[model samples]
Target: MSGNFKMLAKTLYGFEPILAKELRNLGAGNVEEGVRNVTFDGDTGFLYKANLCLRTALKIMKPISRFRVFSEKELYRQVYDIDWSDLFDHDKTFAIDTTMNSEVFNNSLFVSQRAKDAIVDKFRATTRQRPNVNTHDPDIRINIHLYKNSCTVSLDSSGTSLHQRGYRISTNIAPINEVLAAGLLLTSGWNGTTDFLDPMCGSGTFLIEAAMIACNVPANINRSSYSFMHWNDFDDELYEKIIAASLNKTREFHHKIIGYDKAPSATRKAQENVDNANLSEYITIERKDFFRTEKPVDTKLHMVFNPPYGERLQIDVEDFYAKIGNTLKQNYPGTNAWLITSNLEALKYVGLRPSRKIKAFNGKLESRLVKYEMYEGSKKAKYKTDTQ
Candidate 1:
């Protein structure tokens, strides 16, 4: 393996440990968990593998340079010191994204502009032509992180965010992000041992992610592009070998993965997305109101879903949540049901005391991932309330 370098994988809140564990399992060296990112050492092939297989990662970045800067001039000098031509050609278009948490840099846009100037100047001095900056779509995407007086410049190896797995061409209203979906499933400890279900399976994100986890399928198997592919040092043969090896590691899944949605359009979209992900063999979607359905499986089932949170969909939040509780208590037995919702007021109407409640965020909204365990042959779940 050539070009063994340190890479940082960014993830959502409460997922650092899982991301670190995943990196270690993937044979990454020096796997260290940061606030919302994981740092690891891997070669180019390993980078491709990480981007393709990491379910919880939102982006994988390859750091090219690091320096200290107390002022704008120092920042420009530091940015210019790096050999930009070594990373990409002058013919390519590039964009700079900056994240600043420092006293020296006031505005991230200004920092990006300075960084861009340094790179363009370097390119012009070397090749007599500078790469144009394309903010929307760029051949090379550079990331600048300024913490206090220290700065880290990295190449965005996963160009368009790993969440765009390329399989979800169709989506229903309030469709969850693929990376978030995978992280939530991982957090719930879904390991393919039990049957899986997503009652309000809008676009079947949970079902598809669950099936992939159960079958040991790579997370970004359907994704076609990566930022590293445009890098100057990219090796086609090595990347192809990594893909082939990853595909070879996919295992068999036995348990059933089911999805139910009240809306026929949602069910159809989920089915189409599932089929697009090549997971139709492991997942099944049906148009049925979850409130009207019973536990389909005889064995212990693991259920996870995101119900209508009253933000996007128009529904009586109180009644909808109460019905969810009623359905689980009356029909679902021998099941571990987990749901994420931001509607705190509606959660009270569920009429169930969650056995476990984990604080989480659905995008910017503060949310809770509550769990309800319904024992076998028991009419009431662990968290039944008399309010119903």
Candidate 2:
């Protein structure tokens, strides 16, 4: 067994705890949570497993060096001291991303530029040839974090964000990030046990992510690319073994996973993406208006989705939200519905108060993930007072 090394997995707001939990469940050691990242320890194989299985991680970073920097010269020298040539080949491509939270550095782009120059100079001096810099898509992506005088450099193991699961080629008007979708599902206490639905559906992100979680499938099982694959120390056999072991652990899901969208275009796109994930058998996408339809199943239903936050949908936000509450209260019962939206004002018109409200961010918009419960068998659903 290779010895353990420290790593960090970045995530969205309010997701640190879930990411930490995911890391612990994946056998990571000393798991700790940060502002938007979780720190943990694992070996190389564990790293591969993390990249493959973590549903909430945006990217897994392997910190290689940490030092105190005082000046640009020292920064260049320190960055250049690393053995870049040993990490990847001279023919490979690379890109540097810098995050500065200190007064010592003003511009992140400048810092990234300095680091990139150091890497290029290091390669030229050592191997008489330098790797090309490809920002859009690179073989290796490097990250630099600066906090006051402390600087740490790490490698981005997952080239594209884990949200880019590679299965979502067909997108709708508003598609939730895959990692964020999975995290929201977990937060709503969704597993593979009960029926699930995405009323608005969009591109069926929640449906696909929920199905994967239900079956214990690796989040990135459908993705074929990773920056680690280009690393000099990458072991193809070890990765294959990890994939096989992960696939073996997948459990069977028995509950119904359905999606409903009023727009036929959305239903078509959702079905296309579901097929891409090879989950068409488990998820059913229907071109039906949720407000006019009743729950397809008689059992308990768990629903989570991202409603149009008044950005793309040209309708009265307040009236639309009110209709949502009325539909659930009148038509759907024995259901737990969770929705995320940036329009806080529209929530008040819903009439029924949310049982739970959690702060979350849908991209740049500060939003709330609210839950409403519709009781079964004629017991009037109680409304919580809208406390804006």
Candidate 3:
């Protein structure tokens, strides 16, 4: 537990609570949830585990400095006061990414430039050398956040976003983000208790995430690297032990995980991605139009998928959504179908009344994750009749 420090795990909007819960379950101390971020205390090994296990987090950051500033000069002064050379050597490259919602700073890019100047000047003053800035691929990523007069500087422990789980090499068009797909599955109350399905399985993200969640498999089991691995204090032995211990906790999943897509290419990509994740044993992919297929299982089924939103796909939106409703109502029984879509106009065409509708975002488009329950018997699903 040496090198234990505070870390912040950043996530998307509305995912802070789930990320915080995940942190607590993973033995994080002083877990506090912020807007799109969660702060907690853990050691270097825990940092590795957090990156490996957190399904909702986009990145994990380690805060190095926090100070109040009244002016731009003060910002540069405070940033320069930090002993930058002690944190990393001048031989290593670094990059600064800044976020600002304050009156003191007009542009986040300017703030980042000033901060980088301070760090570079400090390094040159001490070692007579300056680390080159490699924005695309840096050895160390520095995050600067300024709100009003308060500012915090942290090291980005996760280099690329944690959504790059390294298992999804092949992706279909409009394949959902890995973190968003996992969060949607979690919010739908999917816990591997019964059979699972992704009717419009684009690259099988939901199916793979569901299988991993059910099997207690580490989220980043296939990921090969993290920003922390390049840090000066990274301990190889400790990291290896952490990986082994996490893998030891993996449990068995008895229920089935299934995926289906009308497009043959999508089905093929999903199969390849599942195989890359080494999860073919737990997932099955089929190339069948969801509307033409029935619920494959008799028992209660948990289903989640992202149907085409009609933004890029050249399909008749109303007809497609109506077919989805008809297929679910008449064929899929004993199933809880959860789908995320941004087509509000098309959603009305579904005809079946959604039991629950939660607001979510599919990338930049605001969407809703609606749930439709199909009972086991011949009870007609309730529908809202037009009064006008």
Best by lDDT: 2
Candidate 2's residue-wise lDDT over 149-233, tens digit each?
9999999999889999988978876689899899999999998899999998988999999999999999999999999999999
User: In candidate 1, which residue ranges exceed 4 Å CA deviation?
Assistant: 1-3, 379-388
Q: CA lDDT of each candidate?
A: 0.90, 0.92, 0.90
Residue 1, candidate 3: Cα error in Å is: 9.5
Q: What is the C-alpha RMSD of each candidate to the true structure, in Å?
A: 3.4, 3.3, 3.8
**With candidate 1 superimposed using the best TM-score fit, by how many Å does residue 90's alpha carbon deviate from the native?**
1.5
**Per-residue lDDT of candidate 3, residues 33-134 (tens digit):** 998889999988899899999999999999989999988889888999988877778888899999989878789899999999999988888889999999
> Which 10-residue span in candidate 3 carries the lowest summed lDDT?
379-388
Q: What would you estimate as the lDDT of candidate 3?
A: 0.90
Model 1, span 335-386: residue lDDT tens: 8999999998888999988988888888888899999988766445433643
- lDDT, candidate 2, equals 0.92
Instruction: Report how far residue 384 has shifted in candidate 2, in Å.
Output: 19
Local lDDT at 226 for model 2: 99
After superposition, candidate 2 runs with Cα above 4 Å error: 378-388
lDDT, model 1: 0.90
